[model samples]
Target chain A: MSAIPQFGNWLSRRLQGSAAASNRRGYNAARHTDMAAEVWVIVRIFYAASLMVSFAFITPTLWKIAIAEPMLEPRWPVFWIHWVDVRLGATVLLIANMAAAFFAAPLYRKRWPRVALAITFFLSVALMLSRGYVNNSFHIWLWLTFFFAWLPDSDSRASLMDRRFRYDSVRVFVWATGTVLLFYTLSGIAKFIGAVPMNADKLSSVAPEALAHLVTKQLMISGDESVFGGLLVQLPTLGWPVYMLVIYIEIFALFALFRPALIPVFGWALMAFHIGIWFFMGILFPMQPLQVLLLLVWSPLALRPFSARGAIEQLPLLGSVVFWRRTKPNVSLMKFWWADEWPLFTVIAALTFLDVLPELVKRLLAAM
Target chain B: MNASHSRKNRGAILPLIRATTREKELDMGRKNNRFKAGFAAILVSAYTLVGGYGASFNFPEIFPFFNWALFSFPAKIYNEWVVQVIAIDGDRLSEPADVHLIDRFDHFGAGEGKVLREWGKSVEQGDLEAAQAHRSLFENLYRRSGAEQVRYRLVLRRSNPVQRWEHGTVLSETVEGEFTWVKDSGEQP
Candidate 1:
């Protein structure tokens, strides 16, 4: 009996010592922050908005006939589910997903409902995708939403205005950012490695020609011939450069990941690239506009404020405010990553207004 | 002496910081998350390798996005629009639907058209394996579209991608392949 008591005490001490060592090493609270109130608020809001917008655009018409009609005989399901089971599951999940998207739109820091919403959202997307030939464009959106679902619930708004940053939220935000960056980098690497090598026959290369082929076919089938892509197909020199630029963007995305400040710049540039794709190619990647609205606008670094006259005064050649008394607030070049800043968010929201507002309007009009 | 002192020190803290249920749950959650993150990183790295070396190494099929071959444009410069011509004649149809036919079957779902078009392209590109793999499924799909006899044609409309609009002319249209429709008796439209 005495030996057993002694052994218990020894075991308890060992466990406690290990726990203390772990705590001292700071493994439990790595990259903890209670900062970036404004950015966090915007992220939470935009994330919720993306979900709402996605649900709104979902045409239930895609799966309605599925209940009566069997799935394509040749199609592969991601997992084995009976035909009747799939129909019932699809109906239930679709309805559940829409409801979750609606209820979780605010994205309050509630654990249970948020988790429930995330699971349903994931299942619904998987079902939707598995039903057809997968369009990989939607994959990023689905995964990003799933990441946000796992984020620790908080009064995100309270954190936004509060000066002290929540370490947990910041960690989650950083992980989300890294994951998105990783996705882009992987896409780039894939493109570079899989690139159709340059050869005597230009069309034999898949890099630029395939994209052109796909878009032109879509445009021609739709009975529209006036797009710039049609013109590019005619001009090899101009088109080749554009194709190279795409491969570069996909591969060089790795560099953009480490430079946190440049994330916004990369996001905007990618957005422009996608817009060009939409113009030259008739296929609009549906999730892209929403992604730009939510993720691209967020920057962990605060932008340095600028003043024109002050800049002119500092220039050697230019007639300056040096000719007169200069007045400008000196903005610090370095800022705490956790500091709240709204200018970038405001600017991005303004730019994306033309892109997303129309869809919001269309959805409203359809409802009406 | 040092061991005894350390033991005494551990006992003082151990009683003060007993592993509560909440603490234990947090620890488990953290461990679970770390495992998930590590696993995800490994999967991503594996996918990257597969994308880069898939042609050299015979790996299982990956997602089209990860295939990397999606962007591989051929080096030889010839502009051509690959088009599919389907001719169908059926029992209750008002008339035989030719290349430009619009029907209820066409509008059923977007994926069907896209995948079918891709399959035709793959065949035209001389992917024998793809064509062979999809033969039965393709037949079934054709039947499901409510067509009795279907004539399938893959035509290449040759033009300069850059100057296609400028010339407003097809240099040549080559028929890559044409197949007569044979019905599988067991399959119903």
Candidate 2:
């Protein structure tokens, strides 16, 4: 929280035409152009491959969707899912979804082509949400594909030749970064607000039993018991410190977008956090870590090798040290007014809508 | 973009080292600014609409919009629900074993485990609606498992989740309840 202003100041100093951009003499500009071409390809491949990896999560539910016997009650009661099997031969549906992922880059050019992808994309969503199959990873990856499609493919057109790259690549990169951070922050808000002192009277206290209950239930439900998970739940406290660390990482994750070195820092922390959830409970979200690999690790120009620092620039917290001794980054961030401001507004509203306000609404409606 | 001017003040955004496009970008200058703003606004609008009290669409649970709600509620109600589906033979119940019901639902099986835990709670509270719904679900599982013609026992156990092992008691948990879904012989209790 304290370092937020510093990141903003770095962006501000450059946009305000301060001494920041003047420090560009430290590196070569041509190499950066070639790197963008490489990064452009890497981002797309990483994303498409993530879709293929979703097979692990998707495979087990094949029989559930295939059998035509719906859940006891569908989560949303989507008419087709509950009544008629909307996914005709869910096996065929799975192949279509995987095919869409592979065809994404070639298909996103203009009009007639995108429709083919959209049909398959929506079908994947239906398959994912059917038979009580709902997961956070599914939602995040689906949206990433949607938002990332809007990003420009300037690398193919002209190799970051001039102003076209910002209009194309930079804008969407920032947009995608801001959008994902919104999701993480919203989830953090949901967890954080639960432990607020004012809400302490509730039977479900987050600090004491959030992990105990979740760890126990997930392990029990999944039938994948962990000795650590069992021992942790029976402890004197519910490991609130670990809980606080997660909330802090998620809420602050978006700020990593502002500074290059910070991306991998938050990226590593988030990936570790996701793995921690798997260890405690049998749940696994292969996409979250994979997506983090795209956004923070491989995000264009995010932690792209520092001219002076070699591959060390890609390391987690240590990467920030590459920027530490420098006067300023040779690579200045272009001002993204709309992309920058949306996250601030969305995060506040997401917190309000997800937590306290809903409690207020439920109470108000009850009172009336 | 002035080639000479870009040579002097190169824009370091995006691909990091392009002076040539900087001037053209500045010259074109926010042509789609309104479009960008509107798109951001639309995303925020759609987001707020689909949400509810820790869930989505005013339903207790919904896809994608769900918060995963870990630790927000008490998990003690059903710490471990393996749902032993044992068969009943002449005056004897078959040996207890885990039912394949977990495989029938949940991508990772935790989703079904979580629900059966909820079912256990609802059953404890005498939730008739839940029973009606769960009866159909279990009947489907029984039919799929080919466990007809013999009565089956659905037993739930508690693992003493929050408490420590008292005096090294290996048997910390006991069968909390039993449910019967008799297929034939008109034998349900």
Query: Each model's TM-score?
Result: 0.60, 0.67
Per-prediction backbone clash count: 35, 2
Model 1 spans with C-alpha error above 4 angstroms: A1-39, A57-70, A73-78, A83-85, A155-165, A194-226, A301-368, B1-43, B50-114, B117-189
Score chain A of each prediction against the true chain A by TM-score and list the results: 0.63, 0.68
- State the lDDT of candidate 2 residue by residue for A171-253, as single tens digits: 66667776786677666666665565443324344555556655654554444666468667667365666766787777656
> What is candidate 1's lDDT per residue for A39-70, written digit by digit as tens?
46555675576566546654263254344333
Q: Which candidate is the best by DockQ?
A: 2
- Tens digit per residue, CA lDDT, model 1, B1-189: 699999999999786677675598777665655554455445445554544443222222233323333434432334333334355553333432323334533332334444455556566778876654434434444444555566655555655443344455556776766654454333222
Query: Residue A150's C-alpha lDDT in candidate 2?
Result: 66
